[model samples]
Target: MVNLTVTQLLRDRALADPEGVALIVQGSAPLTYGRWDERSTELANGLVERGVTRGDRVGLVFGNGDWADYAVAFFGVLKAGAAAVPLSDALAPADLRFMLGHCGAAGVVHAEGLEVAADGWTVTPGVLRAEASAQTSYDGRSAGDAVTDPPRPDDLAQILYTSGTTGRPKGVAATHANLAYGCGGKRRPFAHSRHLVHAFPIGTNAGQTMLINALDAHPAVVTLPRFTPGRFAALIESYRAGTVFLVPAMAIELLNAGIAGRHDLSSVLLLGSAAAPLPAPVAAALTGAFPNATITNYYTSTEAAPAQTIMMFDPERPGSVGRAVAGGRVRIATPQGEPLPQGETGEVWMRSPAAPRSYYGDPGSGTFRDGWIRMGDLGYLDPDGYLYLVDRESDVVKSGAHKVSTIHVEEAVFGHPDVVEAAAFGVPHPVMGTVVAVAMVVREPVTAEELRLFLTGRLAPHEMPAQVVTVGELPRNAGGKVDKRALRSSLTAPADLAPAHE
Candidate 1:
């Protein structure tokens, strides 16, 4: 394995193909490989001049169009021996403030129009105005020469904040080796392919990893400022992209947008989905749409890279998430910490070298036990070694002394002919303590009685929803995971919807 830092990869690429296009955004001018190197070097020099130093944290708060500059900024920070903190663009102002403050960022780089209220120095595109001076030769030293004192592989390279769906966001400390291992391990096959299109927010770990992999492979990357089904199809057609990364919601949207016959997507070789579970129906739709493509689903978290198993596209195993990748192992244990028998449901635990060293600034210790990180997900490994996800442990609904897996109910409800999407949650019930209530987006008007009848054959009597509410849409988190907490808050008294009686 060629153990090279991300900065070294960029410098190597710049040296190999300076004139080749490195980045292309929808509205912005394309940046050539040479231009990217020069700009990053200039920004690194600028940051050094502006009081940034080794071990300092530099926060980045920008959208996709700024990825090129952000990449430069990120490498610049790394080159200066500082850590880069990339904040999500979708974060609320208060959450953003908490994260920036928690990370104790020395400075932040934002786009021109975003109004961030961090108590630190802010750098924007305006800093690039020093055209004549920005071109200075990286303080008169090349990147290769400045690497005499390169950072150790275990040194913190970046701090990525968790999605905070459960509570306050926590910073995940990632090392250069952790990232390089994750990026480099997946580098070869992707790089050898001719075409790959990435359509994720630039600040996300998925996005950063994809960027590094794309650059390392030197594949054609089609960037999108934000995901749109129409635009995605056009890019694939234009570039004849062979591989694509999509969140589950984006996959559904593509199907709803009728992408199968609208474009000649026959050239696509692989389709990967992550960030959330792709319902079996949607996965089937994708298989039908891209007959030649190998569809794969991955189970992972921001704190751990390639932490768990990956289920590659196989028609026989429809919903299985696959077995562990190289250097990773998984265990299924009960709530009381007892190991479950194979084919029994339990919480999923994973061990991988790519897992975070620790949560940043957290006083608590011993999160890892004998190299395994508890993933807090509910699932089981089949007797055949295939991994299956039941649902998020927190998402399980407790009603009338019975625990119901919301994913199971939602899957059954979504299997209904008229339903497009289904979200299940616990609603207040006077007698049952809490009752299973469901909200759905549908293609046709289906009465609550009809839905209950449809679910009768699919779910247990107690597991079926007590009341069904129709909604046009379900709220989602930044990564496009359905925000069940938000759905629970939107509920009115269950008396409004006609209650289903046994």
Candidate 2:
């Protein structure tokens, strides 16, 4: 019932614990709550003075390791009554320009030496101080605090861009209420110590979730600016972090690198992964990696967030994504969007009381319908209402005139002891129209025939891969989900990336 906003989440935290550690970035000084609040406030005032008004859009152009400035730009825009459009640091000039124009931002804020190709006024964190200093020429008290207005719960706080698997990325408009879920207006008691850890890329849904968790779930957040298997393990051990979140991709790397065994990772109490289904083997490996932590997998999307199905790892039901939690509801629906019987696979739809957001430019497009999001995934609810993901509707291959779930084959492939990761899709075959194809990464040398033999009885006859390929690694999008679209598009390229034959 607390009507607190995202800005209030930070303000309340600072007032309650001004000296509390807020952010911990490797090779940088830790930031305190009081400093974060004051710095963001100053930046908010600066943007306001530069004519960035309420309801305006402001772009955040920051790269990895620019956490401090990114935080300032993010909250400053929200506190200034403008929506923060967080652009990916990996964006090229063309992509950056499109988003800036797409969001129709009033201006862009970035750090010095951070290269970005864009138009309109460019504001930096230093500009806030510079403007405050320049005010001394008129009256010398100090522009002390920028008197910017706070946003309401309904106001758009952030416009996070989706991974654009289907087409160009669309801006997901998130209101204050959407971002402020689960904060409870105060920090959680430090169960093990005072820190939580994650290597989530900034500007991502997972990254933003960690940022919000740092505000109220724990006193400090330890971040891995650039993720590497060794670095990820070292940070958790170095900080004695109690809770951690990783996408399945990162978890696989950690297991492959075997750093968890080398590091003292027993301090972890909560181990969560999202953005993709964790294969049975990866889930089992993670339990061994963070032995003391509770392993959890969450199901959510950019279109339907804050509302998700959260499943604590249950070995008996290895593939389940878990039941809905945190005031969220999930249902399997027919193509017409009507609810289907339990255990029937169809489009997965999510409903949340957190006041759902919409696409910025195309409001209420087919995806958002009557308090529900299409989720773009095909899944089923167990007789017990436990949800299980199958595959993206678009990624489900029609092979040999029968629909085949890539996940079905991938799951069987992952069950193999030596397979590290696997991706299955339908490739054009003049005879079958489309035939099942698989690409994989393995722990040791394994031939395609060996894998095909292993999958013989595990999958349906039609679901069996017509061809097998071995790759160095699976390509991932910004959200850490496997880029199946990119993989499908490049299947025609040279044999270097994927070695497969009809």
Candidate 3:
């Protein structure tokens, strides 16, 4: 059967390979397709019995240790004809309440020991058993009718909230067709590997993608309860994991901790970095760390899933995020929505081959138009059609008359051997509107002036940082992205710094 919906993927997989291992969490038992299907169905029956009807929204709050249960809850909501709003346990109580309320959720399915207060009914996975008595007092229809009438491809499958770095978080709703578009092929994804590993937390697009891969791909998914340099290395060595995925932050930690020499990572054939850009220095260092692996970087946003640029670490085009693959298209557009000439810097827009997703209530949002998604990034296309990012739209530093790319400045600063991590942003200046400032984490002793001198050869005079401060670490948002908004609040450039150039 061709799987057009998420529930069908599990149903078909369970029927074909009932005992095949689907998911494994470190320090926990493996879950087979048969058990996964049975447990999720049980939960779906429970949800239906509790008055969750078609098109209803259900919240799923889970921690990393609860990946197995989380997977069950995600599919169960679909089976009951409701959209699952998966949230991380790391979120604050107020944030959780705000999201659930914004969605007008009918109920929330939480992991055991996690406190969730929703206006609608709330139940934990433990009490969803057939034998366990119902927790909610709602007088609802029988479970049989709702579960039998499963959701269609156009029905809402999931709602993922943005990180809200710019403003309040917005919910991006995706229908079943949007998620299950390219997932119907006979050959499962990543077929060369027997096991795939990732540490993406719950409520993230990457984590949800992994869940779909576990359902549709050939390899059994493996993950850790928490991501640490040592434990992650041990898991790779222990499982001889062939496919490993991580963000740039984790990549930096692995390189800095020197875990490659301590553990035998020769089994890693494909090491993928996503959710953030991979700096050129970090990508170069990763090659030596995983000698047998092909380092790949993926670029996409929450609204543009299954439609990303995949760059396979080309030495010649180190900064290019690669052309759009998988039938997707990428183009540079002006602020007025006109396409720009090649090699011209402008707003980046990408169109997905799959059905597009939009803000839950605001389908008319300017972010999406005519099947194209504005990537919220500023970049240009090379002559060969590869995309090279200049900077984020919000991260561009505008000086007196010149606009500087923070990514360009950070990349130049990262070239320093002693520098571990760097973040560049705009700081207020009296003469110029805003001047460039940078914060860095370094290993060895290096003064601001010395680092600025090194950047002199790489960066233009106007693009250089006016102020440089050393820090032990950079501030990261809940989604693991650098918080430039927070940086702007706390850091200020020195008055005695060099003046901005015309």
Top TM-score model: 3
RMSD of each: 2.6, 2.8, 2.5
How many steric overlaps are in each model, in order? 0, 0, 0
Q: Least lDDT summed over 10 consecutive residues: which range in candidate 1?
A: 128-137
Cα lDDT, all candidates? 0.75, 0.81, 0.88
Lowest summed lDDT across 10 adjacent residues in model 3 is found at 130-139
Q: Whose lDDT is higher: candidate 1's or candidate 3's? A: 3
Q: Estimate each model's TM-score.
A: 0.92, 0.94, 0.96
Candidate 3 per-residue lDDT over residues 324-414, each given as its tens digit: 9988999999876799999999999999888899999887899998999998999999988899999999888989889899998988999
Candidate 2 regions off by >4 Å? 133-144, 186-193, 493-502
Model 1 lDDT tens row, 59-127:
888787677666666766776677889876678888888888998999887777877788888886448
- Residue range 1-502, candidate 2, lDDT tens digits: 4466889888887898889888878878887888888788777777777888889999998766877678767887887899999876877678788888998988888877776666788867787657744663222223545566578888889999888767898999999988886666333645566788888887688888877776777548888679999998999898888888899999989999998779999989888898888777788888888889889898888789888888888988998999888788899998778999888889999987687989998984999899988998899988898998888898888865588888888989988888988898767665566667788898898787787788778987778777777889888777788887777776743332222222
Name the lDDT value of residue 119 in candidate 3.
Answer: 90
Distance from true location, Cα of 402 in model 2, Å: 1.5
